[model samples]
Target: MSNPLGGLARRASFIDSVRQEGCGVCIVDAGDFIAREGRISDKNSIQLRIAAEFMLQAMDRLGYAAANVGEGDLVFGDSFLAGIAEGLDVQLVSASVFAGGARPFAPARMFTTAGITIGIAGIAWEGFTPYVAEHSDPGRPMAMAATADAMREGLEEIAGADVKVLLAHAPLSELRILLADIPGYDIAIAGHDTNMEPFAEPELAGATRLVNRGWDGTHAGRLDLTFDRTGALIAVAGSAVLLDAAWPDHPDMLTLHADYLARVAAALRDILAEYPVSPPPTGTRYAGVQSCVTCHPVQWGSWRQTTHALAWQTLVERSRDYDPECFACHTNGFQWTGGFTLYEDTPAMAAVQCESCHGAGADHCDAPLLPYSRPGEAACLRCHVPLHSPEFDYGTYLPKVAHPKAP
Candidate 1:
C-alpha cells in the first residue's frame, strides 16, 4: 500500500485483521507515507516535524516490515528521515535516492516467515532529481541513476531470496516495462503515480504479480498468496479494502491520532495568537460582505444558503480555521492585496463571502452601476480543482448557486 499521508485511524485495524488470519504477515509500504507539503506549517516547520514523529511512532507500533524512502518522505530532508530510520523497527529501503554515489538506506530487506524467506527491495522514483538540486546542500545533489540501472542493481541484490517482492515507487507504466526486462521478482507493488482505482485483481506480468492501491489512505491493497513447498507459485488472491467510516478506528492509533490533532490545534492557536488576523486598511477597495448585503439582499440570502457561507465554520469544526492551506479557500480575499490575513484582523471577511466570487465589493457597493467582472468557471477552479473536488463539473455546479438578476 502507499500514500498513507499521516492517516493513522484505520491502518492499525487493517494490520490486526491480517494478523488475525493466523498466517504470517509482511506489511510493507511502497512509498509516500509522510505528507510532503507539511501539515500545519511550512516545509520542515516544527508543527510538521512533530506530526511526522507521531506518524512514524504509529508505524513502528504497527510493525511495518519495510517502506520505500519516497520523495515525499524526503521532503523534510535527509537528516529528518535518518533520525526516524535510526529508531524504527521497520527497515527503510531505497535503491535510487543516493548521496555521493552510494545508497543512503537499505536497498533490500529479508524477512523469514512460515518457512519462506521473502526478500523486499525498494526503489524510489527518480523524480526527486530537480528537488535535490534546489533544496540540498551546495555541490551535493542526491544522485539519481537511470531507472533500469537501479532496478537491475536492486534485483541482483535480492536474487537469492525464496520470494522476491519489488516495492517500486515509480511510474506504473515504467514498472510494467521493468517487469518484462527483469522477470526475477515474484510480486511488485507500484506507487508514486496516480491510481484512482485499484486493480480488479492481481495481474501477472511475466513471472511477477503487479498491484497498486491508488493514492491517499482511503483504501489498502491486500494479496494472499499460497505457495507450494518448493516455493513454486500456486494461488494468489488480491483485493482492495476500502477504509471508510464503517471500519473501526484502531484503539491505540486513535489515541495517537487525537494527541497529534490536539498538538497541531494548539500550535495553530499559538501561531494565530501571536500574529492575529486583522482587517485590511480603511482606504482599501475590499468592503466586507456586510457592505453589499444592504442592497443585494436576495443575492446575500442565496449565498448564505450555499456551502460557501459555512466554509470558515467547517474549518473551525475541524480545528483548522487558522491553517494556511485551508483558510484561503474558506475566507474572502485570502493572500490578495487588502485581503483577509488573520481572523483577529479580518473577522468580517470570514467565510467565502461575496468578494470571493464577485471580486472586491467596495467599489460596487459605492456605485452599483460600476463595471464588475462576472465570475465564471475560472473563479471556481481556484479552489475546486482536482485534489479537493475531482468530480466538479462547471456546467453542473454553476446553476446550483446561480442567482438570477433581480426583476
Candidate 2:
C-alpha cells in the first residue's frame, strides 16, 4: 500500500527547498482527499473516519491555503465534513455545492504573495448533483449548480484579483466547456479525472492553462507563472514531480502517521470484537496453505518463493497491518466468511494463499477431482488494480506466478 505519508514527506522537503530559493509559495489540494466509497462500508466506517480526520489535521499542519470539495469527500455527509472543516485552518471551497439552499463553503479566496494578488475559486461537476443529494444528511440536503454557471459566479466574485485560478473538480470535457464559457481564469487545476496522466506541461483551454497531477499522492504538480512588470501574466510552465525514495520522510509527518496507525488499530480491534467473523456456508470454508502443502508439495514450494507469500510482511514493515483496506488485499479471505479475521486467531491465512485464487478449498480438499476453479485474469485483477499495481499487465505477470501442474 502506498501511504500518503511518503508523498507528504517528499512534499514537505520539496516545499522547503523551494522556500530556500526566496520565492513565495502557496500549497493547495484539488480535493477527493478522502478514500473511495467501497473502502467505507458500514462495517469499517469508524476506521476510515479516523483516517479522514487525520488527513485534515495533516493538511492543517502543512499550512495548506485551501482545497476543493470533490464528490468522494461527501461519503460521510455534509454535516460531518462541516464539523471537521470548522476546526481546520485550510479553507474548503466549492462554488457549485450547496446545503439547504446555501453554499457550504466560500466560493473563492484571495491570497497576496510576492506582490501578486491571486484569487482562487473551486467548483464541482454538476453531473454529480444527484450523488450530493443522496449522500448528504437528511437534515441538510446538498445540491450542485451547473458547472459553467457556478464557475461564472465564482470567477465574478474574484474579478478584481491580479490573477484568477480555478480548482475544477470535473472531467476534461466538462472543464473545456467551463473555460470556454467563463473566460477569465489564468490557471485551472483539475480533479476527479482519475484516468488523466499527470500533465508535464499545461494544456491551453482558451485563455486558461489547465493542469492535473493524476490521482493518489504519488506526484506533486508545480506550476510556475511569470508576470511582466505591470503584473500581467506572461508565461506558464508546469511539471509533475514524483514522490519517491529520493526524498526522506518528514519527521513531523512520521509522528502523525504513527499516531494514526495506533488509533486506527485500536478502532479496528473494537469493531472486529463487536462483530465476529460469521461462519461460511457448509463445505465452503477456507483450508489454509498447510492443507495444500500435503497434496501438492512442488506447487506449494514454488508459491512460497513468490511475492504473494510475503504480502503480509510488506504491510507489517510499513506499520499498516491493521488497516482493513490494506489488510484485504495482503491477507487471504479477509472479510469473507470463514476467512481471515484477526492475525492472532487466523495466522495461517496471513498472506495470499492458494484458496485466495482458487476459492475456499475445503470442498476441493475433500475430493481431489471435484473440479477446482483455475483462476484467470479477473481473479488477479481483484487485487492487482490500477491504484495498487499501475504497471500490471496480465500477460506479463501471470507467467511469473505460474506453478507446474500436479503430476
Candidate 3:
C-alpha cells in the first residue's frame, strides 16, 4: 500500500498478482515511490531522476488510482511532479505539501470500484524540507503546512464518500496523535515507519484501523474493505504480502525495467562525456588488488578465493556493469577518492579489490612503510549494509577476508 521506493520489478509482480484477482481492486500508494537522497555524485543524481521518471510512467501504466506525495518523491521538485501527474491516470494527493504558494496535489481523490466510493486523502510530515532542498534544483522549493491541520481541512472535502482512507506519510506514533484530534476517517494507511513488519499487529483507534508495511518495497500491504450501501463499514481485513525471488515478474514490467536501465545507461554515458572528472586528491589514488600481490601474496591469493574477487563479474553477468547504483558496491573505490568512474575508465577497479575496504593505496605503493588506515567496521558497512547484505556481521565476516595487521 506504500513505500515502493524504486523496486520496479517486485512492484510489477505485486501489481500483476493483484490484477489477476479482478477489476474490483484499485491500487493506492501511501508515499515514497521514488529514489531516495543520500551521498551521491552528479551522475548518481541523473540516474535517480531518470529512474523516477520511468517509475511514474510505469505506475501510470499499472493503473494506480491515487498516490500520496511522500518526502522522497520531492527529489525532482514540484514542476516534475506536476508534469508526471498530467500524463498519469493516477492522482497525486497531499494535503500538507504546497508548491509555488498553491498545492500541487489534490487534497483528496475519489475512486469508485465495486459499488464502493473510496475517498483517499494524503498528508506528509513536516521534516522533509531539508531532504527536498538537498536533491531539488535551487530555483524550485517545496512548502508544507502542519500535517494535522491540513488533513483536518482535507477530510471535510471528502466526507461525502463511502469509505475514508488517509494516506499519512508519517510514523505510527505521529499518526496516532493526529487521529485523536481529528476522528473522521475510517482507516489510515501509513508509511515512513521502517521498523514495521508484514505481520506486525495493526494499531486501532475506535473504528479506525492503521496499517503499514516496512520500508523498501520488500512487501506489499493488502486491505479489503466491505461497506454497506449507506457507507457504513461492515468488515475490514489487511495483510502484507512478501515480494521475494519466488514472485514471478510480469513480462511487461520486465520489459519496462530493461528499457529503463538501457535509457539510464545511455544518459549516464552522455552526462559523463559532457562533464569532465577531476583527479582524486593528492593522497587518495587507488591501487588495484594487483598492487598488493607482491607485498602480501598470501592475502591477495586468499582474497581471490573469496567472493569479493568476483564482484564485478556478477554485475557483468546481470548486464548491470554500467549501472552506477549497482557499481557502488560491486567495484572498488566507487564514488570515493580516486575510485571507479566508468567501467572503461577504471577497468582495473572493476571488482571489490584490496583498496575497497582499506584506504587508497597510492601512498603505500610509493613508500612500503607508509601508514595506511586499516579497514574497520565502518569500511565494511559502506557496502555490506542492511539492504545489500542483511546478514552481514563485522565479527563474522572479518575472519573471512582477514589479513595480517599492519605494524
Q: Which is the better candidate, 1 or 3, if ranked by lDDT? A: 3
- The TM-score obtained by model 1 is 0.81
Task: State the weakest 10-residue window (summed lDDT) of model 3.
Answer: 1-10
Predict model 3's lDDT versus the native.
0.76
Report the lDDT tens digits of candidate 2 across residue range 1-407: 23332356677777777777887677788878886433445676676678788888888888788888888788788778878878788888889888888887899888778888888898889888777788888878888888888899889978999889898888888898779777899999998887677785888898899888577677778888898988899998988877766677878888988898899887777756544465543347787888899989999999998988998999999898887778778888776676888888898899999877888888778898888878899889988876567668899998887889976
Which of 1 and 3 is the better model by TM-score? 3
lDDT of each: 0.73, 0.81, 0.76
> Candidate 1 or 2, higher lDDT?
2
Clashing pairs in 2: none
Model 1 score (lDDT):
0.73
Candidate with top TM-score is 2
Candidate 1 weakest ten by summed lDDT: 36-45
Please rank every candidate by lDDT, starting with the best. Answer: 2, 3, 1
Q: Which model scores highest in lDDT? A: 2
Give candidate 3 regions above 4 Å deviation.
Answer: 1-6, 37-43, 127-141, 194-201, 227-231, 270-283, 393-407
Clashing pairs in 1: 277-342, 277-344, 277-345, 278-345, 278-346, 279-345
Q: How high a TM-score does candidate 3 get?
A: 0.86
Cα displacement (Å) at residue 60, model 3: 1.7
